[model samples]
Target: METRSLGEHERSTSQSPRVIALANRAGAPAGHVVLSAERISKSFAGVRALQSVDFDLRHGEVHALMGENGAGKSTLMKILAGVHASYEGTIEVDGTQAAFTGVRDAEEAGVAIIHQELNLVPELSVADNIFLGREPLIAGVLLDRRRMVRAAERLLERLGVAIDPESRVAGLRVGEQQLVEIAKALSLRARILIMDEPTSALSASECETLFKIVRQLAIDGVAIIYTSHRIEEVLDLADRVTVLRDGKRVVTAPIGELSHGAIISAMVGRELAASDRGAAVQDGAVVLSVRNLTLDTLGPHGWRRTLHGVSLELKRGEILGIGGLLGSGRTEILESIFGVQRGWRGGSIVVNGETADIRSPVDAYRLGLALVSEDRKERGLHLYESIGDNIALPSIGALSQFGLRAFARERALARGMVRQLAVRCTGIGQQAASLSGGNQQKVVIGKWLATEPRILLLDEPTRGIDVGAKQEIYKLIFDLAAQGLGIIVVTSEMPELLLLSDRILVMCEGRQTGLLRRENATEETVMRFAAPGMAAWPHGTAS
Candidate 1:
């Protein structure tokens, strides 16, 4: 779709005046054109991803690439990254024809890509990860540990990230891991950098650091290809804009040439109903209750505190949203209730008039509870298993009898969930990893649905999926709620929370700051509660 539509599809803000500084850079003197592609076309198994597409990136310019999910943005970037190269296209770099054989070839050609999903060896130290393949060696044999550490520290400092080079990659949070990827790209001496949805999972402050780095890189004459679902970032960061729809370029213009709404029109070829945000419904009863929950000072890491004497309730036939900035202990709270975060203190859970002590996910499941984790690749699915296996995993215990694993019974259960969840796959036997992101997320949800839980915990349920799939997921959530399934949705997207939630709970710095009923919750109120620094005894007076 167009820029406006894309903005509406996803959604952004400003702190300093520098937030809008990219607009001024668009009018600056042009630099050399680093790469150009002519009539580029790519197809996968007879399905065309790019058709007669023409694109070029000028050195020292931030080129914001815009498209709806599955609109070929990732495909086009992959082509440049050499992940897919058997396509019909003519690529030229610095006026010379170029061909890439693989990702290594692209890296050698000074092209680097930071994907939405980070690629880092958790067991390795930061220094080792940055120089994973091309480690500095002494006498061309042994690894030069001191030199690598020094180099990594220097690079991280340059990128404004304060991290110890000796720390293991696993010790870092998602945002820190992303920064390491960037440092690795810089280590490659990359003249061209492609960042795909780099800020999608970032907190607001983390995004600012990333934007600063991008601008500095551009000023140093590096060509940047930026893609994200958040359109305002494009309007704020891109020197030029290009929109793609259904594998074709619709428009290319400078940032000043188009308004947000106009860009949206170009993306979808028409305007969407202005009111089509998400589902709207009210009047539901609370089925799950979490009261005064706390976890004793957690170790330094992903989330410091699971819950700070936090309390909330999820109603049957209602979508309750837990709103917070990333790393604000949102996911941890969900995990605690699901019994994944053990050793929680001073919390009582009341389910349908009965109190329960849930010490593990097994215990939670026995109490009719389920959770769809945020990290689908790592925590949500069995990547090596068939779709049937993953979907039936949660309910396998109940599906079997006489202490024996039953294959036929499992397949039957899988088929039912597959139909109910509307998972699109060639067959139930397909590997879970082979399915598209939307379908993968569906499988994740289906696994929980198979458990037939009266209470469901979803953390970033629709993250990294296409618009169509997002719509389907929303409908599914509502459908489950309509069927008396109590759901607690944890999300960073404000509009999504407002649209899908019957009630909203705002968390800031691991403390419950505010609560809003459906009738009174606005984006501003939620944000205010979510902001840090205030007396922590309930910011909202609304009942």
Candidate 2:
């Protein structure tokens, strides 16, 4: 692998505007345009999501759509994927103007889209998910199970993915589920493929595999629209880059003419400050401690231990990071600490030197502990409920009077939280489902802040949001730590773990493999402990 300083690249690219323009012109050569969108405009509820955005995809090229949250990247992709039929645009495929009525129409026109969220029924078999609507029939009336499995096998083999066709989708890992989504797209014989943040949940190794598959697909003459927040991945994978800001096209250039800083600047319309991962910080006394934590998960193969005597210490005014691959007990630790794990046992939890009895989330909260779960939609917020209601749910008792609900007090508390968190919304009455990803995350954090907890357990705090939102969340974490709150953050992004963590505890296969201070932590050093079967670090005295 080549080693190039992103800072140096940004400095050099900042001085070369003409190079960018030349690369943009050189992107699509003659007779190579496979798909083009002209003057695309879209609006929803009187708000413009996109305005006269023009984009083009060439044959055998990876065109990346870059932007911050609510910057119309997904809206524009939805237009191409036929998810939104009411948009002003001229779309041409194969040099002929075309209009799609729905997603089925787009698929029929040789277009397929893999959404950021995996859309599959977990109870269904892999084969059934791949050939869901258009299954092969034995005699036009009966379902051809054998032929469907066989066809699914062929698709998986083509992508170099190894998974059982007859296995339930629920049993597969997230990376495997992503491969299934890709296989489903390829089974449509798609000529144009749209991938939206395809690697948000994938591990480092799985990401490399997905990148290889993407390159091979491009080699096979498929035009791909790749969207991601990881700038390094974009730099490595994309052939051409198009940036959007405030719902308008900013620039389109080849990857060679762009740098990490240049692309970020284009996306946010400003030069972003470089992140300092090793900032100096003072560590206070241990505020939270766990000893001999273990959890058992019931599976088809019977009960199995997921956590094996995991232990860690979190200090007041300190950001503790838990780094590990998927299913490595990082999340389970949080769940166990929050008292939400069903079969967790043999754990002794101490809060501020007091042995705490946390039999449920209610008990955990009563003991000054709050957990911001990874699945915000399912666990953190009520999607259909009003924003004010979601914010006030956890603190209803305090806002109530004489065992009756105090509507006025509830509204006041909700308004204060919304303002404090800078949660962008029409009003407190706006449903949580209507807000953008970043604002929704803020609301989740605000809900926990309402509890006045001394310890915060955050699992993937900035999972699916864009770069701008991520920066805001990082600042929020720092602010919370400055306020003397003990924070434990579990994140898949290595840069995030290093940037926000005062000290990182690396886990592998349900064990603490290594612990390193912020100054000593690096991607390679962390991964050495995060990988399975790695040697464990020597125990250090609790600070």
Candidate 3:
């Protein structure tokens, strides 16, 4: 939280003369310009991904590039990282015009980028992956394994990361993998580091550690280009901010000049309406019920219980929330109800007052149940397929005739779902990978809607999306609940849980610790229940 002035690192002897010259142009005694791009424009098959966008980075400063999904932030970063060589732009490094033809070219020019989707080989050792292509060699042929491991150890130590260099990447956790990625970037001696959504999948504790490393890098005269959808992180870490919208630069200013609302307005091009969850829906009949669900799993410590006699109920047209810390079995409850938990036992599920037999996801879907898992990329949509194909995948039989898929009817259904969900895409034929994060999530939801589900199980539905897209999703959820759909949402964000749920179920160590109505839920109350081994509340406190 300490504030360091840009001038604090100006006296470093490592700065190049060109950087000093660029610093003089700023008309202030601060860090010099390390990299700049002017009039960056790119097009893909007649679609303009970026147009006349301008950006610059200064030595020892953390500059944030932010925008809604499909707003050209990634496109611009790709150009800077040399991933797209056909872009129309002029890049200047150290006050000299530079043209990078490939990723290697950018790295050689002292610029490196860590993509949002990590690019590490899971089967390779940490040291081998870090120095894969540029590995040290003896006699111009033999691999220098010792040298590579030693170098990797030094880099990891510099970043305050503790990981065995000989360990395979497949066994590491997400946060450790991220740190390895950073260590790899630093091995290139990069003067400008571009990190895209670095903390998207990281836990709260890991984020703090990463923040410390980022700040330290800046103090060491590294120019950092940071991009994230989390606005609070931008406010906390960025020295300056550049916002892009619709493939054009909207504004560039000091972080002190922007407020939370201003940044949201600029990214979305309008004010986002606050969610109104107070207009309570009159509770209808019990739509789904679960009794005494339990699960056993083998972990590092040995056999352990994941879920301990968990029970919950959902009413028609109601949004029920599940809240808990990570590993508190919030996701397990949904997986148990959806029949995806293979080890679940001693549970009875009743749908509309009849004993239901849901042994698999297909059975759950046939019972008018749908689950939108948290990891969309891995579990939800097929990225390689078209939007229409993904949407029609769940209900192919319904759209088929004589065992042949009805193409015309399938396209019509996909189009209808896209329209209903307000999905932004060029057409139904576009691949799911081409769409942004928000649209990808929408497609996942649309695929389930094709099955005509009555009860929706959404887990972290808004996890890596922008504020504007989150607002749209909230509206969509409310609309669905109004149409008599029972919604069960499991979220880690406290505000989202409070804003969306009429009643919340708090879990602690896989047990139903507390249930609070909307009128009584607060951050403190929810945390108290979510804490492990908390004392029992008074009888009748839970609604």
Candidate 4:
């Protein structure tokens, strides 16, 4: 713990003028450090999450935080946002020492955080979620519906999105939910805003809108602390960059003071080799086949056909990619084959020349098939459970004897899977919730890998992972394909689909638009096929 006298604080406030501006917008006044964290150190279960790290924000600057998973980026953000109260540090706001006891204390001090993981109640309306705890009252006894809805609408409009304030959050898409979280942060009107992976789920158009809003906010004097893995966005939006690695600050410099290669080297301590373009496989036999795979989806009106006549053939030792924009039935295709019904799935799947009648996940596992879902936290891993338990969950029944759980067998399998995936953790007893985003994804995949499935399905395999972790996953996927596993990947990233897939099956509006080989699939080609009016409707059916 550290303490500062009033005289010392006043002396530190008078800093040299150094204006940091965004492109085309006027910069904030220099020497205006709105929030500052000095000598912050924190530990969890004897593991150092952060160690004497320092961070500061200007009055109207977009300061980007860059780091790999488990690099103390999230830990430092949590400390500054008041999620971790007990830490060896001193925080200051406007040259005054402040100790935030909780999230409320931080909010009251004009500081707010928008977490990577969304923090909205799914059952509540969009307006209700924005004004959750601090609701507007009509007469000190009744809820102020009109005021809240109007305020929510204003926030949504400011972000340039068309979302209904009255709509339930559960009905919105993942990207929409992310926007709602941003709107909630805007409602606070905080002077210091911390955003973690804000554009993870955003579409291209949505991202354009968000960047505009962020630039406008900076012009309006809202100091922003931005965290993201997207290099181009950080280079474009951030006025200054601060990188952390393994609980220590690597560097802090203006955006112009660093280059692309320099930033990657600083964060990873090494140059990341680019992935070579993999050629299409034309040798292996067809391990899986789906002809006219169709499924129903529960939309706003009623059950609608989400997939129409979607057919693809995946060969042994091949990486087949499913490419499409959001809501283009890319996920529904995998869900249909895995028997995870979106709305009464109707599809035909043949595995290794045999039909697979998968009615549920258990049935899919039994039929030599496994699926790694997109939402790892909600659908894949049990957060609070141990790594060993999560890894062995799918096959625990087979390892049991006389209806008694075989704890020893479970640990052995978990350890083997952990070794195979090169997961970074303390031991098998570590909870999945405590792991980084990349490690958590590995656990989810390991959970299904225990089933010894011949076919694997991955959805958004590296959504929020850092560059270093992404390289590891790419190598792991290549290794799995080399081991004769038929793999299908669903990804929204065009470059990833082009880099990893042997062949891409492009879809548009729930219809198969085109099948492009490795050399033929470019960003332009993929987007052209993914656009509307390219795919014909199945016979007489309508969406």
Best of the candidates, lDDT: 3
Query: What TM-score would every model get versus the actual structure?
Result: 0.86, 0.91, 0.93, 0.90
Give candidate 1's root-mean-square deviation (CA, Å): 6.2
Put down candidate 3 lDDT per residue, 1-543, tens digits, no spaces.
122334554554467534543343343333778899999999999999899998999887889999999999988888898899898879999999989999999999889999988999999999988998999999989999999999999989888888999999999988899999998998888888999999988877789999988877877778889999999988888888899999999999887778999999999999988898566675669999998888887777887889888878899999999998888899988988888954736679999899999889988998999999999999998999999999999999887999998999999999999999989999999999999999999999999988989999999999889888999999999999998999999998888999999999998887878898988999998998988787533321467
Error of 4 at 526 (Å): 1.4
Can you write out model 4's per-residue Cα lDDT over 1-543, one digit (the tens) per residue? 022233454366553212224332233343388899999999998999888899999876789999999999988888888898899989999899999899888888888999987898999999999999889997798898999999999989877789999999999977788888878877887778899998997888778777877776775567899999998889888888899999999998888778888999999999989876355433578889998888877777988888888888899889999888888989988888888866766668898899888888778888889999889988999999999999999898999999999999999999999999999999999999999999999999888888888899999999999989988888888888877889999998777888899888888889988887777778898787888887553321111
Which should have the higher lDDT, number 1 or number 2? 2
Who is ahead in lDDT, 2 or 3? 3
Candidate 1 TM-score over all chains jointly: 0.86
TM-score of 4: 0.90
- TM-score-based ranking: 3, 2, 4, 1
Pairs that clash in candidate 2: none
- Flag the better candidate by lDDT, 1 or 4: 4
The 10-residue segment of model 3 with minimum total lDDT is 21-30
> Which residue pairs clash within candidate 4?
none
The true-versus-predicted C-alpha distance at residue 109 of model 4, in Å, is 1.2
Candidate 4's C-alpha lDDT?
0.85
Number of backbone clashes in candidate 1: 11
Off by over 4 Å in 1: 1-30, 137-150, 258-284, 297-305, 401-416
Better of 1 and 2 by TM-score: 2
Candidate 2, residues 1-543, lDDT tens digits: the string is 111233443475564423433343355341288899999999989999999999999876789999998899999999999999999979998888889999998898888999988999999999999999999997799998989999999989978888999999999988899999999998998889999999988888899999988876765667899999899998888888999998999999888788888998998888877555345354658999999888888877988888888888888888989998987889989988988956747779999999988889999989899999998888889999999999999999887899999999889988998998888888899999988788999999998898889999999999888888888888888888888899999999888998988889888888888888887889998888887778754542122
